[model samples]
Target: MADQEPIALLLLQKCAQVEAAAGLVTAVRALHGPSRTAPIVLLTEAEAKTDPKSSSVDAAIPIHCPADHAARELERWRPVSLEPTRRIAGILGPGPIAGMIERLGVRLEAAMGMLAQERIDQGEAHRLAGLCGTLGFAQAHAAWLDLSLGEATSLAEARRTTRLTLAAIARGL
Candidate 1:
């Protein structure tokens, strides 16, 4: 039998803001569902603070990592069940991941351009970081983490770093 597309289960840990949440939505929407649906599970420590409502998520799970609630859920809930012929290819598999990167291309360029004109928001920066991780671009992800999470001193610097890193990721893709 042909290799069935692998099932994907994305577990996102820290999605607090609406814009950051929207980034996840944009990333997952790139999948558009196929032979099997890739479900997104949102986990948060501060559920009250984060608001846990986004269009892209299949399920929102509120729990403190390493805490009882999270442990119990991990024990009870299975992420996926594959048939004998099918296996898990992961969300970062070549086809879906490449597609996601392509989808983000226009947005990334536009965001970089906008950053030149005005200060970009944390959400936008974080969104780029999230996408980098999804694409398995570790260096790009680290650069984005530094910029979005305050390692960079200025927005301009972050934008410059992002643009460069995005080019690297595009080449790798």
Candidate 2:
């Protein structure tokens, strides 16, 4: 029951308010999944040039308000789900941890029991490290690198577990 909602992807392509646009994106992305996973599309003045057939996004929506209403839509997405994300909401206004989680401490307790100490893959460790880089979970995602420096027991197994943890965190996003 830790995560039961669907992911919601939001886009901030139509708002003229530069400040609010980023704030909205941070807020939406910070939210825990289970609703919809829409990435903020940022419908800028050159939105016509924005292509929709590109990445792993679910849906791209153009904000209507050049100033206020666009941000309002993101707020609306809130409260629609029962399991609210208070931690994510807090970061958007003061600071966004999109690219600074490397300095944070990682909690590998949950992942330890999921995968054994010998069944992991090194390539997977690289992949998980990349994902942690993306999620800004610096400390939490550093387990792969830290483990790589130790004795060579289940290095591969350790990394695969790390990658799985990264995937779970990403899905939560």
- lDDT (tens digit, per residue) of candidate 2 on 39-63: 3344445324323223222123353
lDDT of 1 by residue, 49-112 (tens): 2222213444455765557766665443342122210111253356765576666665666665
RMSD of each: 16.4, 15.7
Per-prediction TM-score: 0.39, 0.26
**What global local distance difference test value does model 1 have?**
0.51
Q: What is the C-alpha local distance difference test score of candidate 2?
A: 0.40
Model 2 TM-score, all chains together: 0.26
Q: Lowest summed-lDDT stretch of 10 residues in model 1?
A: 80-89
Candidate 1 Cα errors over 4 Å, as ranges: 1-92, 150-157, 169-172
> Residue 152's C-alpha lDDT in candidate 1?
48
Best by TM-score: 1
Residue 97, model 1: lDDT of 53
